[model samples]
Target: MKKKINPSREWYVLYVKSRHERKIEALLKENNIETFLPLVKTVREWSDRKKIIESPLFPSYLFVKIDFRKESEKVLAIRGFCFFVRFGTEFAKIQEHEINSIKLLMEIDASMEVENNHIQPQVGELRKIEIGALGGLGCEIIKVNNENKIIVRIDSINQNILATIPSSYLTQLATV
Candidate 1:
């Protein structure tokens, strides 16, 4: 039996109706369920004006923290909340680091890569990162493509998403 704790919170992602992401998020928050919706800032044009909007990076998806094994039924019964992300019999836990990254990312202009795998990092802003357990290595981040993959070149090996670095254990690479 899953142990029940008063605040047995673990990060989880829920699939919801697209465009209903914010609505579901608001509703859940009102219910005392802590939630997070990762979004990217973009401009949307109305008839007379162009307005900036924060839109979901992952459509139909939102993250939350709750004691699911104990409160699973409550979360599932929520209208418009499609389902909790799962793997077979267990609800998968969202990496805490991802939560932190998403929070910090919201405060800055960001880009993602995956399908259209190309990153054209700005000239002065190009940062060479010596990361991971490889001791010290060089990586260049350019454009944030559609796939959310960070294109990095390590020792002439072009890689989509540097395979080694922990997003949290980063130290700045000194300029030559």
Candidate 2:
């Protein structure tokens, strides 16, 4: 009997060659595969001038929506494709809400910074944003330069989104 393929589609992270995120996204789109490449704009100063350019929020990483069991070979065959982000032996699957949260952050155009490999020991109280554009998001408060900052951890991606939020907007969550 042939092995079964899952028909349901889900989001999975793909690791691609350095600086090849846009290229991979285009290639996947051409093949009718759904992809999400989150990008952010920043000003870069050159020796002669300064210009604003858009760059991938997460370097060398992008998200794909597919039934891995069905499309694994095709996706892997693409040029610049490295491998799927995995946890131990199993592939890492991203939650839809997490994707939406990222989208929401981008939509609001919030001043944000991405910290990769944020595996430091957890510090400070876990609080929820109660006001402003970031309201409803759970974050951890950390002291940066003697000032409080909120870190929204996207555990699956091993990243932390650092943003400066006013103290009044934060409410400490009751520990169980």
Candidate 3:
């Protein structure tokens, strides 16, 4: 059966191997596939010196939007490029709002306000932080947007891209 997907296709998450996110993304782009990788810049320091690095906001995962024919050879070839996130025999579909939230975060690079489930910045409100430390964990927020940093950061080193709490977490110290 030919796989059918409509126009205005939403983003899909792929399960590429750890450390392959950037390369697979590059390969997909080389093949004209639309992809999005949310990233942030942070200064990494060592005894020698400090360096600014641009890193993926979500580690080990990248988003792609494309229509594939189920029986098409390219689809399988793309799958063979790396591991595909699966639910039994299917590539798992990433939640739309999650991707939206990330894009929204990337767009803003200034102070943001956090109240309830919303993150308000000079640009606009992005996806509501419905889960995790900002929402799901049910702890008092440390801060909203800390210097354009996505703290309580994520590790790109693994395919899971799990969130890690910062040693000095965000907290609402004062208000305007």
Candidate 4:
């Protein structure tokens, strides 16, 4: 039997308690609510040893695909849920493509690597990251090391994470 789809159900962004994103996601799923908490696997360095852990890509935020009219209160009742992000009087809706994009980014293995020396360019060329963890972000390629490793500054996220992506994944922006 085919399950009926609810046309009103859309992806909505929610702010949850700090450090409680995963817990809330588990709770919502137990209650039969569809939730998406995008996470990234990274190496965490400690004084003694290094540990690889999965952390939320966007801290304190998760998306729920639900019929807001019927399930808003149920979502709010979850202990860690803070509130829905609002755009004017209405709750902000996340485009389906954006959610899919984030999922695709997390799936990419970019070998998150960084070079110590900061490369500065006289004039930087703007380009888009077509693949890897920082996909969809616009970066300025400041330096290309032997044509294999290029230094780029991702301007969208306030703090940039260093990752090594193949140059073939980059697309040069045409001059406007």
Candidate 5:
């Protein structure tokens, strides 16, 4: 018999315990639940030398593709699983384009850096990258650090991740 795919299933983002993303992912997979955990390769320092490590792109966050009408409880029961990301009282179902954009961001070369600055800037226009790797995704230009570095904000999981894009790669989008 072939496994049935439920059309009602939707992708939802779940908040997990800090640094336990991989563990929760493993547990969910072991239980046969579909999960997507985006990771980024970063270099870490130690007394001996530098070592490259794979870190969660959005720390403490993971996505699950499941039929929310039935499988949400199963997801909540998993260890380290917290509440679903919500915008008011209802669960926020992630769109396919958002997931695709994240995959695109992850596949791009080491040019992208995770933005850690919590300060939200009040300036800059929303623009789409039209040139290279980040092409076609909508982003907000936060600041122009110099001629070569322009700080840009990319949205993920109802939050923004900042990356410094080379000036030539950005094209200003006219806001109407």
Candidate 6:
């Protein structure tokens, strides 16, 4: 049996056209719809010079907070607005805590890279940070370039955030 979702405002992911994330975000906000487009600054280099640019962390995707039954059609009608991300027939809903996690990540300004969720076989066990900035955040240890890295998977968006962390801050979680 399918589980019933709460009929209140919840976070949903929307897939938009390539490189149009910011524009769509503006349009959605103009319509009074709450949206979150997480962006990160990166330095881009060219033959002439280097310039810093802000780009969406999750390219081609953004999160919208809405009551799906009432506001979905309004969202869908906007220009460059695409359909909501889905798992089977149901919309993929993001938990409030997950959104807060992303917000915290942005606030910390950690050096990290986003990877597509085509994760390889686990090399190490699941662990959580015991101290420091990301304390209490659960992550899996993965071996990359002969070094261990902490990978946090955001399942709703099919992305993994890999950050360089010292082993001393890690505490193994008890397996059920």
Choose the strongest candidate by TM-score.
6
Q: Candidate 5 lDDT, tens digit per residue, 38-115?
A: 899999999999999999988988899998879888888886777798878878777766676678778887365434
Q: Is candidate 3 or candidate 4 better by TM-score?
A: 4
TM-score ranking from best candidate downward: 6, 2, 5, 4, 1, 3
What residue runs in model 6 are displaced by over 4 Å at the alpha carbon?
A: 1-7, 112-123, 130-136, 144-148
Q: 145 in model 3: Cα distance from truth in Å?
A: 15
Worst 10 residues of 2 by lDDT: 113-122
What's the best-to-worst order under lDDT?
Answer: 6, 2, 5, 4, 1, 3
CA lDDT of each prediction against the hidden true structure: 0.59, 0.79, 0.50, 0.71, 0.73, 0.79
Tens-digit per-residue lDDT, 1-176, candidate 6: 98455559899999999999999999999998889998888899999999999998889989999998899999998999877998998888887777887787678766544343333324677887665556677888887443457787777777777776556666778778
TM agreement with the true structure for every prediction: 0.59, 0.81, 0.54, 0.69, 0.77, 0.81
Best by lDDT: 6
What value of lDDT does candidate 5 attain over all alpha carbons? 0.73
Tens digits of per-residue lDDT for model 1 on 22-117?
999988877877788877777999899999888886678788888777766767767888887666676656656556644655665443222322
Tens-digit lDDT string for candidate 2 (1-176):
98455458889999999999999999998997889998888899999999999998889989998988898788998988999999899797777777887877777666444333323323587888776556777888786433457788877778778877556666777688
Once model 6 is optimally superposed onto the true structure by TM-score, how far is the C-alpha of residue 159 displaced, in angstroms?
1.6
lDDT of 1: 0.59
Candidate 3 ranges with C-alpha deviation above 4 Å: 1-5, 70-80, 110-176
Local error of candidate 4 at 2, Å? 6.6
Candidate with more favorable, higher lDDT: 4 or 5: 5
Residue pairs in collision within model 4: none
Give the residue spans of candidate 1 off by over 4 A.
1-7, 45-49, 111-176
Instruction: Identify the runs in model 2 with alpha carbons over 4 angstroms from their true place.
Output: 1-7, 112-123, 130-136, 144-148
Query: Better model by lDDT, 2 or 6?
Result: 6
> Global CA lDDT of candidate 4, please?
0.71
- Cα lDDT of model 4 by residue, 1-176, tens digit: 98688888998888889999999999999988999988888799999999999999778878899999899888988986799977678787776666765676678765544433433222265666776655666666655563333344422222244445556666766677
